[model samples]
Target: MSVKTKLRAPSTVLVLLALCLLVSVFAISGGEYQMTPWQVLKVLFGQGEGIENMVIWQWRMPRAVAALLFGAALALSGAVFQSLTRNPLGSPDIIGFSTGAYTGALITLTVLGGGFVATSLGALTGGLLTALLVYLLAWRNGTAGFRLILVGIGISSVLASFNHFLVLRAELDVAMAAAVWGAGTLNGLTWQSVTPVGILVVLVSALLLANSSQLRMLQLGDDLCRALGMRVERTKLLLVVLAVFLVAAVTSLAGPIAFVALVAPQIARRLAGSAGLQLVPTALVGALLLASSDLLAQRLFAPVQLPVGVVTVCFGGLYLIYLLNRRTTKV
Candidate 1:
């Protein structure tokens, strides 16, 4: 008789990383002129022909990489907020920060008319301001997750109207361009724009890493966290700032990618079999999700090439409905 043993599977984070890398390979291989995954790997390792190298290294690589990074950033931000608020629905999209960022962008496109730098600055400034507003409004001695969400919803509604007004008032050409960007397409992404985003991702990730312990402490309820010597309000403020920075940066670049922030953390929580959202697995899930969405956006409609946001919304909307049906508690 032979004895047989079953081995345990890999860690959820590792599995997600592997999946993310696999999706990225296919992402680089896709686009107008397709290539094989083997060819993409060769080009990645500095082999392949000039045109192949140009296509893989120069063109598609930046967009693919950006999608991965931005996805991770959004998920990390979402994890921070959800854990901080102890709310399943805590996300930038729900919290009005993304809409506020878009409002700033509309102002930049219409009023400043300045170039990329000014617009980026405008978006960042706008989101941070909105975060502050939400925090202040939600605070009645201390912020509760439910109050915060309600305030955010109200603010987002107001901003959406303002955003439309700005777009309608702008020149037709500029309005058209802004609309496309607002849709969150990765088309025409180049290394020049991607470099700064990459740097921002690194810096923000480091900040999150350093504050990770505090984040865990915060999750254990504010009174308990305070009793354990955590400066509850200060930590909350700092984490909120970091979260807003992430959402704003992604919105500035990719136009508030839908559902990556909202969905990834919750999904990762289940996959990792954890009661709370874990950052590492969540980030990987986010990377895989956004990359997969971008790939689908490219090929699903073929030459038409829908914006990445459209696919995310289509899929995310379904998830939202299912979540609602579950009757999950807000906090």
Candidate 2:
């Protein structure tokens, strides 16, 4: 990137950050017991009254923070995958990771009948196993994006059927509970619930950011990357693993919240005019999309909040239609 291009990106990031902050404030300030934006800020800084603190710090904050953090995580994963595939539709969820995670959670709930932590672990395990399976299946000579996606689709279809079967066979209470979670809401998130996974996500994100030069280099054709003496396949595999981890972590917390992952990187790349995926800006866009969507989900049907995933799915469907239309026109 040129100096001017680099400068533009940072400015774009700053603006996105500012928008995220504003949206977060708005999100925390809305609800049954609404507060002013100033009050929300005060509560965040630990200077509000009992109710404000309880509402903002205790209830609203975790959900909002989860939206921002998980959204960013999803976007970071998307950036990695899209950069690797050189396709706008290249999202981790396009593979079976999210479905695998959901299947894991379903099994845990139906068999072990475990609580949140157990369920999250189950989801993580399932996601990783699914990734391994897809990688192996796609590795004819070496992994290619189209083959990987195709394998993922098949695996996801099988896993999704298994998930439905599990849910159908389980007790009604257990099935209903699993179904709600599978719908992907930020409704009941608490600090305790979000902390461990949040920390892991931060670490994973740090690793991805640190090794991002390799991701950018991988975009320059395998032969060219090999010419530069990089272990092309190994770097690609490592980055793919890291990207999968980000998705699994997010899925563990919020179920399969879609669209944010598929859309964020493309939006960020356009906004910043980046030649390749720019991680920070993509993350910021994801954060904004999720936070804002969650806020709408909470208020759009006041007193009967919809799962945030529902809003994202609606938006995602529209995005897909637009993408298809664009591709068709070009063809």
Candidate 3:
């Protein structure tokens, strides 16, 4: 990136940060226990009285942090998958990781009745297993991104059907609980819930961002990348593993929060005018998108806060349609 590009990128990031801050303030100040902006600031600074500080630190802070981490994780994973495949539609959900994670979580919730730790473990195992299955099935001596994506979609559909069947066979309350979990929510997020996700996001995101240069190179076809001293297949495998882990982490915690992964990188790419993964910008955009979505979900239907997943799905589905239409015209 040129000096001008570097300057412009930080400028864009500052703008996004400003937006996130504004939404976060709104989210903190406008909920059931409302507070003024001044009160919010005071609480954040640890100079406030009882209620405001408790609300800000204990409640809103965790939820906001969860939104940021989860959103960033999903977006980064999506960007990695898209760049690796050189396909805009490539994402963990598209390639079966999300479904697998969901299925795993469902099994835990249904049969095991374990706590969050157990469910998360199940999600991680499910996501990795699903990706491995897809890779094995898609492999014909070697894996091509195109064939892998096709096989993944087929496997994901099968798993999704199975998930529905499992839910249907369960008791009504259990099915509702499963359905709600699948929809994704930020309600009642605690430090306990955020710890695993936070660690996973930070670690995986750093690895992915550190490898952004290699990812950009990989985008230029496998043979060309190999000629450039890049181990094309091995790098792709690493990316797939990283992507699966990121998806598993967030989906387990947030119930496969939809569309942030699908939407954030596209928005970041347009804003940055970069052909490949704009890692930092994509992450910032993802945070902003999710934070704003959370705020909207809370305030839109007064006293009836929707899950963050619903908002992303509605917004993401429309954005995806637009992407497909645009791609068709370009073709």
Candidate 4:
């Protein structure tokens, strides 16, 4: 790498990290019961009074942290998938994993009337199953990026239809609850609810970082990777499993919050001016995007907060349009 590129990359990542911290602080401080930065710091240090401390620690802090972690997981997952597939559109949400997760959650809610734990297990099962199916179908001689993406899109559409059917057949209250969950709000999340997911994200992210060299190798094409003594298929499978785990964990916790996985990696690549994926920068960008979006969802309409997923979908839809337009122009 060039000396200029090295310096520029680290600076960009640092800026993204700083932006994430700023957004997180804003999220903690700018809720319905507003607190200044001083009050937030006091609450963090256990110096604030009862209500302020409860509000910051019990409510906003957990939600903000969950958003950050979920975004990072999704972003890193997207980077891995995009690298594997060699397609900009390769992401969990677009490829069927998120829809599959929603299907699982819908079944738990509508059929079993399950609680949080059961619903989360169901979502994880659904997402993994969908991923396996896509992998199996996409394996011709071996998995090809374009073929995998096409098969995933088809499976995603089928799962989405089934999800709608499940929702429609459910009782009014159950359907309403399922619908709300599917929209992916971070409301009412406590530390207890987010703790397991936080741990999973941390562990999985560490593993991904450890395998970053393999990931970079795989991006160099299968023949080149094999010539370099990399087990191409094994590396691909491992990365795909890791990406699936990240997606399932976040979907279980937050009901498949969309678009971060699809957009954050591309944004990071562009910002860093890197030909290859930059996992850490992608994660930081995801954290900043989701944290800021969550803040906007809360404060945009005082008394009537929007779902974080809603805001992200709006932004992602526009991005999708832009990508399609740009692709068409190139073609």
Candidate 2 contains a number of clashing pairs equal to 0
Q: Per model, how many backbone clashes are there?
A: 0, 0, 0, 0
Regions of model 1 farther than 4 Å from truth: 1-10, 328-331
Estimated TM-score for each candidate = 0.95, 0.96, 0.95, 0.96
Local distance difference test, each candidate: 0.85, 0.88, 0.86, 0.88
Considering only N, C-alpha and C atoms within 3 Å, which residue pairs clash in candidate 1? none
Tens digit of per-residue lDDT, candidate 4, span 1-331:
7898888889998899888877888789986698898888777787999999888888788898998999999999999999999999999999988888888878887999888899888888888889889999999978999999999999999998998899899999888877877898888888888998799889999999999989988888999988988888888888988888888888887887899999999999999988887999999988888888898998899668788999899888899999989999999
lDDT per residue as tens, model 3, 113-226: 877899999999999999889989988877777887898899999999999998998889899988888898888889888986798779988998888888888877878987
* Candidate 2 Cα outliers beyond 4 Å, as residue runs: 1-4
lDDT string, candidate 1, 1-331, tens digits: 1122111113676788888888999878877798999998898888899999888878988999999999988888888888877777888888888889888877887888967777888889999999999999999999998889889989999998898888888999999988888888888889998889678887987798689889988878899998998899999999889888888888877787878888998898888766754777888888888999999998898877788989888878898888887865553
Higher-scoring candidate on lDDT, 1 or 3: 3
Where is the poorest 10-residue window by lDDT in model 3? Answer: 269-278
Better of 1 and 4 by TM-score: 4
- Spell out the clash pairs found in candidate 4: none
Q: Can you give the lDDT of residue 315 in candidate 4?
A: 89
